[model samples]
Target chain A: MIWQLDIMFLVLVVISAIASVNVKDLLSSAILLGAYSFLMCLLWIEMGAVDVAFTEAAVGAGISTAFFIGFIFQTTRRTKD
Target chain B: MKERYPDVTIETVCRLLIPPIQLFGLYVIAHGHYSPGGGFQGGCILGASFIMMFIAYDIGEVKRRMREKLNTILCATGVLIYAGIGILCLVLGANYLDYGILHQILPAYPAKARALGTFGIEIGVGITVMSVMISIFLNIGTAGEHEGEPE
Candidate 1:
């Protein structure tokens, strides 16, 4: 595993995590969370955990994103806080 | 959902994309023993294809194709298959889920029987995961009331 790619993904993961939590628009937050999942999937692949990476990409990035979007359609887009 | 705004481009793209996506999912499930992918990942891919259909088309369209009763039955069937395999192993004079014992009935070597048994469980898991995912998405999309009204 290249240390540089690992570091890059690590940084991006942190940024996306924080951004997803802090974003006011729930839809954008959901999308950001999906991005976070994908980055984590990348990290898993780099670490040689191919199975986990596959799972993360499928369930974390794909299904959960769709679930969040479906939920958002039923709720308010903007946060109260 | 009641009011339809049909987009030809989206419909065309999804129709073209879904078949290949499903085929890949099946491939993942079938090759899972030797590959990085397995039942859960493959099933999620399959479910995602349906979710894409839901987005591009209408919920009614999806529901019509896969009725709620059929979905529930499929969900149960997968679990039954999984349990049945385990119990079969037990009845074959081995511990639960002991695949090596399957050779007595399968006419294969012990090691090959183990692989076959694992493959069977994976199929069961893939089926369960796919149905559950679709069920969750449908419930969420419809807010727990998926019947009576088209909305």
Candidate 2:
């Protein structure tokens, strides 16, 4: 069961990353990055690095995503690439 | 006052939804040790909660909710609290973060002393993380708005 969860989490991370890169809208891409961080946090929990996981969840999901959105606001949301 | 942006369904949903989630994030920080989380995790969660608010609501609304001064205070306080623990340990004649000495001073069990110490530092981390997040969000959202204008 644990292994299954791990695999699923990994797949989710990959999907989120791919979506983040492929998404045309910067805001949506930022959201995907946040999702990626959240999944990574779960993966850390499964790996038993609770402390690292906690930090990741907070900084990665919270700070980074917020920063990304803020960046989006100061500029245009649509990206050419 | 001027309207900076248009009202939308998504922003409306965010206005209704985000405050409660932020409260939960605080709970996560407070109860981190006992659960599967700690200060940094909870702090980030708290930060994210506000960030969500910033994103969903317009910048003006976010600014109204989070003032620049308070964010500065939060950042400094977190560091002070973290340093306070190390100072306490040093005052007790041990290296930084040497909780055993704290245990010697307190009448309670040594494990309890260590736990308490950890909690203190964790609180510091949480505060730092949350404030830094807010600051970052504000900076990013507001960047280049008045870049070359005289302050």
Candidate 3:
């Protein structure tokens, strides 16, 4: 059961990781990055690294998303690549 | 076109939301030893509260509550508290970062004293992390241009 859950989240992380990089809209990519962090935090929690998971949740998912949105505000939302 | 500021509903909701988030951050810091939270986690929550304010209203709104100078001082003060505790242990003729020596003054068992020492350093780390997160986000959000004179 635990291994399956791990595999599921692993797949999701990979999907979001690719999405964040390939998405044409910078804003969408930023949101995807946040999603990626959230999934990573979940994986950490499942592995019993509660403290590290907590830090990842707050810093990666929360602050980083805010930072990315703020950057988007300063620049264009759409990207050429 | 996007509006310059959040709607009234968002403004009211954020105002209501920030306090609870901040309170939870404090709880996380206070319970770090017993729970999954610690300095860095709690600090990030506190920083997110300020960031929420910035997102809802503007940079001016956050600055109105937390002044830049005060923020800078807090960043330094956290580091001072951490180092000061370590130095105090040294002054008492123990190794650095040794919490056991704190029992000499705190009137607690060596084990409890270490726990208290951990709490102190966690608070210091929490403060430093909180201020740094806020500072970095503010600087980046404004592109090195922030309102309000140094005060």
TM-score of 1: 0.95
* Model 2 misplaced regions, further than 4 Å: A1-12, A15-19, A22-25, A45-51, A77-81, B1-16, B59-64, B104-107, B144-151
Q: Which docking class does model 1 fall in?
A: high
Model 1 Cα lDDT, one tens digit per residue, B1-151: 3456899999999999999999999999999999999888898999999999999998888887778788899999989989999999999999999999999999899999999999999999999999999999998987887764333
- Displacement of residue B86 (Cα, Å) in model 2 is 0.3
Please report how far candidate 1 places residue B62 from its true position, in Å.
0.9
Docking quality level of the chain pair in candidate 3: high
Ranked by TM-score, top first? 1, 3, 2
- Chain B: TM-scores of all predictions: 0.94, 0.81, 0.94
Q: Assess the local accuracy of residue B2 in candidate 2 as a C-alpha lDDT between 0 and 100.
A: 20
**Descending-lDDT candidate ranking:** 1, 3, 2
- What lDDT tens digits, residue by residue, belong to model 2 across residues A1-81? 399999999999999999999998888999999999999999998989887887787678767776776666667536568
Q: Tell me the tens digit of each residue's lDDT in model 3 across B33-95.
A: 999998889999999999998888887777888889989999999999999999999999999
**What's the candidate order when arranged by decreasing DockQ?**
1, 3, 2
How well is each residue in B14-33 modelled by candidate 2, as lDDT tens digits?
77778777777778877877
DockQ of every candidate: 0.91, 0.66, 0.84
Give all candidates' CA lDDT scores.
0.93, 0.79, 0.91
User: How much is B47 displaced in model 2, in angstroms?
Assistant: 1.9
**Segments of candidate 3 deviating more than 4 angstroms:** A77-81, B1-3
Per-residue lDDT for A1-81 in model 1, tens only?
A: 999999999999999999999998889999999999999999999999999999999999999999999998888646689
Candidate with best lDDT: 1
Q: Is 1 or 3 the stronger prediction by TM-score?
A: 1
Return the lDDT, model 3, position B75: 100
